[model samples]
Target: MSLIKFFVLAQLKVEQFIKETEGASGIEYAIIAAMVAVIIIGFSSSIQNGISAIFTKIQAALPAASS
Candidate 1:
């Protein structure tokens, strides 16, 4: 019947759409990762400076040697 054929065609289209979307998911994740990487890279110098300051403070808090 034509109704059965239409239903089959609709199911096939839905399946194809799902498959295409599945493939796109990887690309979406990769793009998000890349954006995060860029943000980290941009802030790397500030992060490094903060870490360095923390270590310096820690060192300064220690007792001085009697040398």
Candidate 2:
């Protein structure tokens, strides 16, 4: 095709992309998922530490254990 036609088509595609809002929601969902993952990881780390402490305390209560 002609260069003018190519440019016109590109302009139309750019305009359509700019006017579309579908991608915005996807980004928002991605951000929400990232935040949720961060929260889960943060809580899980603390939970793991707490569980480890409980196991250590239980271990200490046992007799004939290594010093």
Candidate 3:
């Protein structure tokens, strides 16, 4: 193929790819979901630790049972 023809074909392909948005939106949603998942995972560990400490404090506050 001639150089000009090759460049024209390449440009057309690029324009067509840019015009397609379905895959772009899906990729964006996947990225957002991944970030949200990471945030949830990070918060879960902290929340678990906080809940454990609260339980420990509650146990310490309780009076001992009589023998």
Candidate 4:
């Protein structure tokens, strides 16, 4: 999508959030969700490599099953 469209959508959401009487919980939830997503994306590569190494080690240690 175009940057303008993205900005418009974001502005609308922000306005709605601001207008709500009980907005603190909603904002807190959004912030927590965003932080969790950032953490997962940051660590995902390391986690993937660790899991790959573990599987490789297990395969090397296991003998081939009889046919």
Candidate 5:
């Protein structure tokens, strides 16, 4: 009976340990932050390209000033 009780307590402890979410939250947040960084980097490159194209067109449209 005592041996059975020990095994049961051990099993419960293992289950409780497995169910813990405290340490996992940090990992989840890190993954989310990494994803956000990747998205921002991708968007910034496209935005920079678009702005550069617009400036190039504007520069081409305006005539050069005399020195």
Candidate 6:
């Protein structure tokens, strides 16, 4: 009888552990989002410079309007 009770308790503990681990998926997604945000922030200056260069080129190619 004692052995049976021990097994039941062990099973309950295992179930609790499984339930706690279910949050891991959410944590994984949060980690991925943070990494992507970090990467974007790291490249932001380069992206801005590229965009600025493209616009400058376009402006230079356009003829100035006469007054």
Give the candidate number with the greatest lDDT: 2
What's each prediction's clash count?
Answer: 0, 0, 0, 0, 0, 0
Whole-model alpha-carbon lDDT for candidate 3 = 0.92
Candidate 6 steric clashes: 0
Per-model TM-score, in order, reads 0.63, 0.57, 0.74, 0.62, 0.52, 0.66
After superposition, candidate 6 runs with Cα above 4 Å error: 1-19, 64-67
Better of 4 and 6 by TM-score: 6
Local accuracy of candidate 3 as per-residue lDDT tens digits, 1-67: 9999999999999999989988888999999999999999989989999999999987877755432
User: Measured by TM-score, how close is model 1 to the native structure?
Assistant: 0.63
Which parts of model 3 have CA positions greater than 4 angstroms off? 61-67
In terms of lDDT, the poorest run of 10 residues in model 1 is 58-67
Whole-model alpha-carbon lDDT for candidate 6? 0.92
Which of 3 and 6 is ahead in lDDT?
6
For every candidate, C-alpha RMSD to the true structure in Å:
5.9, 5.5, 2.7, 12.1, 3.8, 4.2
Error of 2 at 25 (Å): 1.2
Residue range with the least summed lDDT across 10 consecutive positions in model 5: 58-67
Candidate 5 or 1, higher lDDT: 5
Model 1 segments more than 4 A misplaced: 1-19, 64-67
- How much lDDT does candidate 4 score? 0.92
Q: Whose TM-score is higher: candidate 2's or candidate 3's?
A: 3
- Check candidate 5 and list the clashing pairs: none
The Cα RMSD of model 4 versus the native structure comes to: 12.1
| Candidate 2 lDDT, 3-62, residue by residue in tens | 999999999999999999988999999999999999999899889999999999988877
Candidate 1 lDDT? 0.90
In angstroms, give how far residue 31 of model 2 lies from its true place: 2.3
Q: If both were scored by TM-score, which would come out higher, candidate 3 or candidate 4?
A: 3
- lDDT per residue (tens digit) for residues 1-67 in model 6: 6999999999999999988977899999999999999999999999999999999987877766432
